[model samples]
Target: MHIHKLPDDVLHGILQHSCYFQYPDFYKWKRLLLLLSICKRWRHLAIPLVYNRVYLSYYDQSEDTSIVDDEPVETIKGAKTKTNLDLFVINNCASLARYADIRILFTSNAFKGLNQTIERMKSVLKTWSGIKTLSLTLVNDVYFVEHQVTAELYDAAQINQLTKELYNLIPGILNLRLKGSRLDRTNKHLYGKLAGYYNNQLKQLSSRHAIGLSDNIYFAQISKLDILLNSENGYKLSQMCTTSLVHLNIRGVPVNYRWASFKTNNDVEQIVFPHLKTFNISYLSSTPSVDRTGTELYNNGRLKIHFPVLTKLHLWSPLGHCELLASAIFPEKMDTFDVLGSSKTMQVLSNMRIPQVKKLYLNVASTTSNIRHATLQLINKILENSPGSKKNKLIIHEDSIQIDPAVIEWSQLTLLHIGAQINMDIALKVIAKLPNVDELTFYNFVAENIPEEAFALKNTSGCHNKLEALNSSITKLMLGHNELGHSKDAVITVIKYLSVRLESLSLFGAQVAFDTDMSEFVNDYSHIYPNLTNVTFRLLTAKVL
Candidate 1:
């Protein structure tokens, strides 16, 4: 029967059987063997086992491919044949998969002539028009062919011709990952030709070309983009700005400059991605590559580039020269924001005008003894800077962190988390302040940390019932453990008043996403907290251990 005629469930079964999981497992091996079998049994067997997923490699355990270095296509005089050859070949007698991986390993003169080899490879590649995701790798090796020291891989003209041929073979390819070699000899021509062949089916693209992701592929229709940032690029971000882009990931080691010694701020006017939503900037190296100081990224108020629709921004561990990158693009205003960065890194953004946000997470990372002080100070700065978002429901991200409720807008906060450094007086003050909190989490919640005002009275007055006077609107409460360990009884005593109005509470655990609208984050983390249904709604006092 024709492929489209297959029932939906049967087609899904075919895809499930052909998909490649971790390496080549039993199912993959069986499928490969069944593909090679020429008996009548093959008549009833599914053809998708071979055509649904394909991995063509030369330096692998399966598949046959050759790699060569071609810079304008040069030929060394007098090729020698004295070299050890390692080979793996899989002939493609039929067309293959929705996902295809081709790793070309160029060998010595032992392989067929360039013309013959490329023709053969092209023939095999021609059958894979169904591929939606394709990963292409080119491997160049230097060998002693009779001590000639040959590094010649293949003719560039031939490879370019092959790439042109591949246009028809993989026209439906949507996701393309290119590594080791540039796909186009003329660069833009081949990429543009491929884009035309696929009819803009390619939405996501990544490259590890020798020069990085610079000047490799150009297609304005691209929705997701990954850029290789280095000192050489020095922040001409306009080249990457496309109105269709929804996500952007920038990362790379400095090619010729160290961030510690390099001083160059981004050209703020060079970026204006109008429809972009998520922007991430980080480094891919062993050394910590953050800018030397906040001043390094400051442009002295030159031009303000804006991302009109940007919502999610994440700056991971190390940023070589991409520090405060969002500040360059997300200038004065943006709606529905999610920002994650250090206190020092975020200090400059304290005045960003965010009218509203769906989620806001701050790491407040520090190596000092007063992390609580830094965390509180940063939170206050953010709340002061973002008046519009002070009333928006949001979720916070941090494995373990503290908070100061002094500057917070109580009614808008859906989640409240405090650390060991909080005073009992301040903790009780939070209960009185939170008139609309849906969830509350406390880490290192020991009684000694609470001031006497919570359980004591004036020397001349009666015992103050401050704990019972609490009016918290919290629905879910989570009590987390501390690194140094805390007295359980002390924690129970402190949370009893806060839990008075809780609908469901989980002790010694945290649900980072609570019950808010960030469904993706919440769904994965909802199971982290222990049994909440079993917990009786009685004031968490003298609670079952």
Candidate 2:
């Protein structure tokens, strides 16, 4: 039936339904071809829709032949046996390559018909002019012989030439991921060429290159860059700039320049990212060649130099350099500052001018009882440093690590996280002052930690009722590493008001209850919060028990 013959309204509905999802297969094309075989009018309606999507795969295998009788022998060198798999894909999918996308992969037979295979891929890429996405993947290993004198060398030369040609064809590609170790040499040269053809609108570029001492691939064009490099040559590529780049993350160790260290000032040479909004950096420890201790050493490269528009900074560094880093990036007006590991640097870190920083995460462990002094210093510094009246968060490692309440002005601090142990009066007063306080987390809990007064107040004045009076936004809570003891009644009473507004609750424990009835409790609470998405209960029990 001709689509034009249908009523105009009916045709519009058909077109809308057809446009719902991008059909990336040749089913539409095959249907059109069948319609053409039927009659002229049907063919006209199907042809235009058929032209929308083209899918193609090319292989060298003959349709009639089976590998059961003749398996190509693996060779170190020679004519280079090729499998029939490559032939099958190519011959079958050749016509479909023009409409949707073109995907190419090497078969065991690729070596046997190297020249023909290269011609086929080049043809597929060229003929598919309408294609927007193209994928080239290396599935299996291809062996090459280092023959003293043979035609095999000539074939190897052809393969290299073909690889170079393919490299030049890839810059126009939108999403690209190149895997395998053998292709590194070809890829490095390819990356150098691609740096020139960078698209300003490029979305994702993930490249895993050899860990060496040189900066070869340019990340200046990629908006989202994920690089896994060998530790030895990791941080050497700091010069490239994509000023418009919004998110930046580097994962690798620093290549120390020790001999020239003190003699020259190691400040960042140029600011590459002025529009950067979020930044995360961590060292890759799994690379076999890297010395764990060596990578931890302080280097000028550890400091973040290119951040003015940054709003969130998530950093994981050891205890020592935390303060030094905070001082270096003091100019950034961050909304969130998260530091991981023992926060020995808190005293120095909190002193830096971070008036714009509202959420400060001191996610760290302390061995000494001196935590109170350090916490006080950090709070005092934060109050003195920040310019204005913005509420903030101060998450101490645990509640037992006593902090002087007077050092921090609870009036301006909206959120608090600490160890489970708390003085009932102090806790209530602190909760009262932060009217906007929304989220609270208690780490390392114990049942004995809850005072008798809290239980009595829950029954009498309903302290849980006062908690209910707090702003509705105060809906999420995390109690990590649970230590619930004998008092289930008291615990349940305290949680009543909080659970009413709570959207999420996470519990981690060795033994939550002697009764093993927590699952029943969780299922009952699941229906209470209308907006609740998840409730997690993680029990840590010994295998023997």
Candidate 3:
């Protein structure tokens, strides 16, 4: 039977599954439009899915057109007629007023007549009354525009007017994001107006290089706040007033010792975030030198900031900055700690004590030899200091360290994800050690500097035997990255030796050549794994058979 002849429920499910509204891409939208053009029933089922989230952007159509006559026609006329995103949204999809999310993007050099563009944006916002989330991005040019000055900057007053109109039109908006617009201290009046309107209803706020807050603003129900910190107008932690905030992410903030001093005041003793639970800080500057000899630095010094209920902490900063922040704000009871950076951060994390940490993600930068060595050292220290009661799950990315079987407590590990390029021999040895791992993931399996005999089935006396005798607790295996085609022999050997009763297998980014038949390979391997029932491939490429 044809797809359109199916039941309403089935058709609706198919349309929902195929819609790409969440991912704002031109090709995806074209595909959705094609699907809608199939038939009336398909259009009826797919309309809501396609209009659930709308992204409007200024698309330059000048390159798509060719000049046929010797006399030059004005490009502005074509731009207005063909590249208008606001007109497309209002003319084509304005009937779907219940769109949950709306994103408006303006390229710095694309639009003409700034005031007209703003008016068009205001009209678009007024047309959509049921939007729960709104995102505005004004992309800046790499160099200054010389010819037409209208596209260089967005007027502060115009932006404020647009924001006020949005708030008045969509009072129930729960999430708001503003990005790439230049608003410095001059925009304090805008913030004052927004603070009054969004204080009670907005639940999440994220901004990048836009809307600098010069005065204190209170968010009554705001729980998650993400901001890209700039030197001029970045919000100070002490200036924010919120009682329900639980997740806070601050990025692009220059790291200096003075950040710890932000909390120190002669009048106020301590600034407290009573209910915050998750704090993430990243993209710290590395130009400043830190004093590592001072013993008082580790005790948080005179800085008095308290995260009374903080449990999950993620730090993506330079080694010195991570150490400095951890020493000052390290909570007593952290449930999950994700340390992502170079070996400098790892070296500092190794010595730190967090006995309450149950789930640790070490995303260390291992591009250099020195960083790889430090990562290995950090892993050893983590295993050494791990508590014996709680079973820990570890995720290692970007580097593979040699595992010393004698020092690691293999039984304590529950899930291990190795998303890195590692020697095949080392991977086999590590798997043999982790007798209790239930799930294992390997990314970019590297088999360099290994003899062919190592993977040969005839070699019964080598480490292959240990791999064959490894424990049977593992049930899931995932292979990832683009190097899978080259490492097929090593992957097959590992699968043949591993005695675990596998239940699921996933291959991601596996490159299949025209000569290779993935179905036949799967059929051949299925007999070896009697319990394997679910097998999936993501981003698999091959010539048509």
Provide backbone clash counts, one per model: 10, 22, 0
Model 1, poorest ten-residue lDDT window?
A: 80-89
Ranking by lDDT: 3, 1, 2
Global CA lDDT computed for model 1? 0.46
Winner on lDDT (2 vs 3): 3
For residue 378, give model 3's deviation from the true position in Å.
4.0
User: RMSD for each model, in Å, please?
Assistant: 12.2, 10.0, 8.3
| Per-residue accuracy of model 2 over 327-394 as CA lDDT, tens digit each | 24534467877665444556656655663676765554442356544665556565556645365666
- RMSD score of candidate 2 (Å): 10.0
Greater-lDDT candidate between 1 and 3: 3
Tens-digit lDDT track of model 1 for 1-545: 97757776786576556544744232354445554354433423444554455544443212222324421121222221111011112433345457656544543332223233334445445455666886765543433132332333334465456566676566677887755433322222233334345434668876544222233334557788665543323422223326678987766544122221121236433445677888775544445344433223334444344567777776553222234543355634454454444444455456455445545544433323344346555566665566665433433344344545565554556666554455456666666667767666555344456544423322222333422334655666665433145454444435433332233443333222122122332233223322233343323323221
Candidate 3 TM-score versus the reference: 0.62
Best prediction by TM-score:
3
Model 3 lDDT tens row, 1-545: 97657899998887788884553454465566677778888878777777656544432343322324442222332333222344346547654534333322222343233233445545655555566776644442334323223342435566567557656666666777665445333223343355446766778887765355544455667888886654444324324554677888877655543342233234343455678888887765455344433222234455445677888878776433563445444566678777666666667667766546767666654434666645655666765666642555666665455445454555556677776675556666676677777777766555454545445443433223322334436655555534444555554444443322234333223333212333543454445444333544332444211
Model 2 quality (TM-score):
0.54
Top lDDT hit: 3
